[model samples]
Target: MDLLVVGGGPVGLVVALRAADAGLTVTVLEPRHGPVDKACGEGLMPAARERLAQVGAAPNGHDLASIVYTDGRHRVSAPLTRPGLGVRRTVLHAALLEAADRAGVQVRHTRMIGIEPGDPRDHARPARVRTSDGQERTAPFVVAADGLHSPTRRALGLERPARLPRRFGLRAHYAVAPWSDAVEVHWSRNAEAYVTPVADDLVGVALLCRPPGRWDPTWRSFPELAWRLAGSEQTSAVRGAGPLRQRVRSMVRGRVLLVGDAAGYVDALTGEGLTLGTAQAFAAVDAVLAGSPAQYARRAPALGRRSTLLTRGLLAVSGQPAIRRLIVPAAARVPAVYRGAVHQLAGGH
Candidate 1:
């Protein structure tokens, strides 16, 4: 095959579809079947929606007009100049899978357990991958989109140690109508609860926080949100993912490249994870088609530079109680700056 994309998630499928469109044969390896779901904020920025549409993977979702941050006492909202989307992870995955099928991209129900880099002396040599079935496959270029805790990245020894306090994400869906058209982020002393409307009668709530010794029940942290959801039926079991920060040594090594969360991840504080990952997928395909895999390493980081900077800045403040408490108030006090920040978060100039 021309390309082997590890992980059949949205970003991986995106790589497959794009490569196939360019007349390159592509295959995707994912142990899980279609409609794979994950614990995510479920809010796609306006730019992300457009990118998915361009690739023919747009899915049905609730429209989001703005972002509102509240600490109960203080609240501020920034309108997205363009509308965003609140899509369930499963729904988004299904859309991407359908597009991949239409593009004639092969989907294999196998896991990639290991990778053997192609000859360093010959850039044209195909890289070999060992699947969980104990079979080996070769492809001219390999993309490791195997998520945050990527086995491919670990096997390659590219994992970097994280120095900050570990934080986790927990998500669940509630069977209740959305009260607002905006994505609401409710802040507490210990954690932040993200409420996004994914359907006419379903909203997803995701929590970003440190391990729960500082707060118990977790729901207690967001009193207002808990009250609002008190009588609502839970639509899905809670899903969690953590130590949110992932650092990587490099994105390129010979004919192999890492995209999406496998490349690196900061915090999802700003809800731009999908947008950033999509940008990496675009850069990866361009580099591969250009016959310059090394260019991806140079281009990937710049693609998410703006989002990373803002997310890191917010994460730092989130760790400091006094500063964190000032966030909503500050944003409220300076509407222009807050709006500019929101515009930048949406991939605007």
Candidate 2:
């Protein structure tokens, strides 16, 4: 194969599609079935939506026009420079799978158990991988988009220890009608509730918190949200992911390039995961096409620097209860700053 993309999630599929569009044969390795779902704030920022369309994986969902920050008593709203989309993970995954099928990208239903990096100096040499079934595969270029806590990243010795306080995220869907065209982020003392409208009759609520014990995303924690969701039937089970941060030593090793969460991740506080992941996917293929996968290491960081800095800064301030109480008020007081940040997040930069 010309490219081996490990991890069949949206980002990995994107890498395959882009490479296939360039006339390179691509194979994706994934243990899970198609249309896989995960615990995530499923709101796609404007750039993410655009990139999905650009890559021929556009999925239908509710239109998202803005972000609203609230602390019950205080609220601040910022409009996205371009409208975004609030899509369910499975919906997004299915679209990508279809797009990959149309592009002739083959997907293997197995996990990568081992890898041997190719000679970085010889672009023609193939990197090899051992699958769970004891089969071996080789490709000139490999992109790992295996997500947070990626085994591929660990095996490659790219994982970095995160020193900050650990945080977690829990997401569930509710069979409730759309409330607004905005993604609502409700602030509380211990956690934040991110409510996104994914369909006319479905909404996704994700809670990000520094858990005190077990991972319980208690809705009562946010009285306002609880009241709003009272008696609403849940459409899906609660799903969770965390420490919410993954640091990486670098994005490339020999012919292997890491994309998506496998590359590294910050908190999902800003809802930039898909946007950054797709950008990295494109860059990974570009580097591979240039016959130097190492260029991806230099290119990927710039794609996520702004998001990393902003998420870390927000997490730092919000970790302190005293300052956390001021976040919504601060945004309400300085609308322009909040608006500019939203614009940046929406890729207006």
Candidate 3:
């Protein structure tokens, strides 16, 4: 094979498809079968939509809109003229798998165990990968999209940069009429609740907070905000995701490369994780085809820097109670600043 891609998530699948389209023999190894489950905000930003189109996998038949931010009382809604499409993880995965198949990439459902990096024999013996099923495979170039906790990264001995003030995430879906077409992020002193309209009658809610496991008290703690969103039927079981932080570093080493959360992650506040991963997939394919791993290493950081910076800045502001109080009021006062922030968060900027 010309390339071996680890993790059959959207990012891995996109890389496989793009490489295959460019006439390289491609294979993808994933631990799970089709329709893999991922914990995410599931809001496809405008940048993600554009990259999907480039890969011939644009989200279709979905209601599209911008995003809205609120401090519980005052709200500012901005029209994301570029508009983002809302698709569940399963739906998006299925689309990418189909595209990958059509583009002639072979996908294997198997858990990866180890990799042989920098071995001269890696070119001839190829990189050896052991699967959970006791099967072994080899390919010259490997792209790891295995996610935040990646075995591939560990095997390569790459150190992940520290993210200050670790946080956790909780998420669930609701069956009810959407309050608006836009995604609503309601900010509080220590945490924020993100409400994204995924369809005409369904919305996804994700809550983020610092660790040591606070937030156990539900409605009692956030009475007003909870009361306002009461009565909506829960469509899916409530789930949690994270330990989110700023993971700043290069995503490539030797023939092994990282895309998506495996490379580096940003705070989920920006809701741009999936979008950034998809964009990196394209850049990874290009760098590999050009036979320049250094170029691949150089490219991933630039792609995620802006969004990561914005996320870090927001995290700092949200971390301080006094700053948040002053910032929210000032942001509410100047609607343009709020709107611009929303636009950038929606991946327009």
Number of the top TM-score candidate = 2
Which window of ten consecutive residues has the lowest lDDT sum in model 2? 211-220
Prediction 2 TM-score vs. true:
0.97
Q: Best candidate, lDDT-wise? A: 2
Local lDDT at 155 for model 2: 91
- Worst 10 contiguous positions by lDDT, candidate 3: 213-222
Better of 1 and 2 by lDDT: 2
Per-model tally of clashing residue pairs: 0, 0, 0
lDDT of 1: 0.88
TM per candidate comes to: 0.96, 0.97, 0.91
* Residues 95-209, model 3: lDDT tens digits: 8988887887888877898776544324554567777878777767788988877788877777466757888888777776676677777777677777777777777778788
lDDT of 1 by residue, 181-220 (tens): 8899999888888999999999999988888623233377
Which of the two candidates, 1 or 3, achieves a greater lDDT against the reference?
1
Whole-model lDDT per candidate: 0.88, 0.89, 0.76
